[model samples]
Target: MIVVVDSNFLQNPMLETYFNESATNKVVIIDYAAMEAFKGDTLTSVVKSTAILRRFPRQVLIAHGTKTVGRLTGTREEIAKAMINDEGTAEFREFSAHLDRYERGVRPDGVERQLLDTGRWATDHLNAAQAENANLLDVFKELTDGIFTKEEISKIRRGEQEEGWVAKGFGLVRDLASDLLSRHPDGSVKLDPKDYYNNFIFRMSLCVFVQLMDWIRVGSPSALKPARLLNDRVDAMFATYGTYFDDVLSLDKQMLRTFWETDAILRFVYAREHEK
Candidate 1:
């Protein structure tokens, strides 16, 4: 069992005694970022509290702040040294830039609009087709054998499961695009769909890339190839929906990448893997 040592607990002598004497020796010290969230009386006290917490085995203490949360096991010392020495590595710099962009609301070209528009279009088409004619339902029924139920459609309308539609449509579009790309003997990329759709690939690509970044941050290099392959499908998705929803599909891939890389789980995994 992992134990989280907050500044409050660290400052209290009794709590510290209990903590040290506890059968579970695993204790992780919360980092400055997380400590900042506390509405404490003084920063000095918090810092002292953190220092006391860190007196344990360096490998047992992890950092848990607002923006950064990772096990301190092995990576903590290196990470601390990097911060103290101001050695901002390329990846760290890139991650910082991504966060800056996100904070400023700087998004990809048209990704947001495309998602909204596609969602609206799907909703409208499904509604109109269902009400006026049985043909739409028949088509869906033929394809899914009633697996896609009316309740599911209703849930989608309520925004309960909108991702399901996006996932399904994206999968279909990606498959078709893949087939086309594979057939091209010259290897010259065909009239890609994003150009027509106004950069739908940008949005889809960002999502895929972010997913990959998250996987990497979690120290799961084994998943890298599959993640990259998923990213490659963004081009195909663009081809399928680029014409219909270009403006809404442009997304800032860089920001998403940064957010995932900085995620707590990624840092935790990194710490676990590098533990001595």
Candidate 2:
């Protein structure tokens, strides 16, 4: 089996023992920075050195970062607006035009190169996911408008007990965007939100984000959302990519709850055990 474990799992040394006993298993660890450190190393080497199961051969994969997938799916304008909320569309377009300068090492002095590098990487990934998932767009276009039966919403609220229900609900979520995209003068040219927003990693991140927002609204209506807390949640959202593997092992209750609510297909090892 393949498994995805949050980095926090490394704090518990006992977990390594369980993984070591299973030689056939593959494990993946997600992080915003881990991918850079393992740049030239083999997957096995990185896994053995950094992952929970050192004795086992390195059989791991890496999802790049929190916003990487999210930024990749939408229209250029949409992505820019999401990243720079205060900026007007024309202003963002002007900012994006500097990519060539940044690439040519013409960036202003004292600017953090890492941030620029990340931007470039995200841009590249966005193009790639678009090309790869382009065929899937038509599949999403067939979805009904944002409306769902009361029973469907009830099941979605109850969380992922049924197969296809979460996917159907996601179709509704995409409808919010699709409805707008459908208004183009060329009615045949509709962009499917899932084609961009619900790509493997982005979908998981969104699920966690939506669930967290719901909690924040209910738990502390007056509280200001802190930057660090939001960043932490984004970090945890990367764990959703664990669905690509066999199972996800996350310690954060919020992340676990979000995963459950989404009815993601991946198994949640710790959550299942905790229930008993």
Candidate 3:
């Protein structure tokens, strides 16, 4: 089966062995952060980095947009120059730059804290909306009659069955998130009611947002550690793409559980400590 391995699996000797033994399989390794650090202004350094990405053919699943590069290189000479520039800039990609830390078994501090904070605000805002608008559920239920039961609506209100409910309604959720979380070029997030096919990063961001909301729905204060949450959320962002793969191997238990609970029928293997 085509298996996707997250960066964490690379650190575990046993898991690495598992991966090595399955070399013939269609294995993919992805680090979204690495790709993300490039979706900005294409400076000299950015061009240099994009060139390095082309070298790793099998490992990287995505590449920088050509249109994006063209924007930075208005002249054909500049474009051609960037195409030939082969100075290694792997260190510029955020995830690749963090390889040393990963090898040392160190975690990034305070990463994705803003996302968690934003999610907390979103939850509070959603709860407030439901409270202030008493007929909200009934109105939605009437509009989506026969699609969602009244009991299901009640469970959703209590955040008791959102995971199962949302999984069952992924197309609906995708449409909603697409409308609600589209990013504007001015570095702002806005709704794109008519556009859902473009903007890969925003789509992935919505997926992560939905997954994090699920965590908040059932999470206790003690269970939501910031560092761990950041790690898991980033891992979840990476794992979202794994939904398309045949199977996914992960050393992170939370990631394995996250994929298993999603609508995506992704086979997940939880890597365990192997005997010496």
Candidate 4:
């Protein structure tokens, strides 16, 4: 099994226990998790996390990989090291500069206003269309006819499953991903969607949320916390990508449950390839 770990779980203390418990699975680290580790206030603990990540037999993929001198280039340890000893590495310097910008809330094309904007856009459009006399809740039920039963829909509408239902798949969600979600199994859009099933279901959940917000006459978009938006997207990406692998490992209970749900959703939605 390919076990993907989250950023918050990259603590020095939990490494041995995690490895001991997952002695049989091939633990992997996604790029998002690695980049997040650089936020460590102490270089020692960050290095410790990177070292533990690299010890995995499988080379952890760094999608936004950095440059390092000599043969240590692009390794997890190198990424952390470059942050501390950037020296003259232009690539790592530029990357760290962006991190610096993010800390000051200047990340333009990043997660600065990621969830806030997305939730607004979704809620805005839904409200505008509802003003046109369209019943979107009916449309939502029609779209998720099989995935969520009618009883589940009623329960969610009653606010029972509202906690992590949106959060579970909210990270892999984007304007483009939602576009894919809206047009899926339709001939209107010619784009191909990502292979992860959570991507599809999460988008569906967003639509479900939009409907619920309007249905209950509640303003949920206004409730989205801007402070927690950054980490929300990060954790969302980890849980979303975890569906592509066999499993995800995380010390956080919420993230761990998301992993289980998304991975299980992937297998349930796609049988042959992911079936155990």
Top TM-score: which candidate number? Answer: 4
Give the winner by lDDT. Answer: 2
Order candidates by TM-score, high to low: 4, 2, 3, 1
The residue ranges of model 3 lying beyond 4 angstroms of the native Cα positions read 32-172, 179-181, 184-206, 209-213, 220-229, 263-276
Off by over 4 Å in 1: 22-24, 30-33, 37-43, 57-60, 64-276
* Cα lDDT of model 4 by residue, 120-162, tens digit: 5544543453354334334434443454445544555676755
| lDDT tens readout by residue for model 3, 88-111 | 233234544453344356656643
lDDT tens digits, residue span 1-276, model 2: 656566545445655754666766655545433432233333322333344433342434444444443434454334422332222323323433443355457777644454445445644543454454444323333443244455654554555345565555445555534443444343423335335443434445446435534433354212423433444444445455543445566566665566554544222422554488
Q: Cα RMSDs of all predictions?
A: 20.6, 14.9, 14.4, 13.3
Q: What TM-score does prediction 3 earn?
A: 0.41
The global C-alpha lDDT for each of the candidates, from Candidate 1 onward, is 0.36, 0.45, 0.43, 0.44
Worst 10 residues of 1 by lDDT: 240-249
TM-score each candidate.
0.21, 0.43, 0.41, 0.45
Once fitted onto the true fold, the runs of candidate 4 whose alpha carbons sit more than 4 angstroms away are 12-14, 17-24, 40-42, 54-154, 157-221, 271-276
lDDT of 4: 0.44
Give residue 177's lDDT in candidate 4 (0 to 100).
44
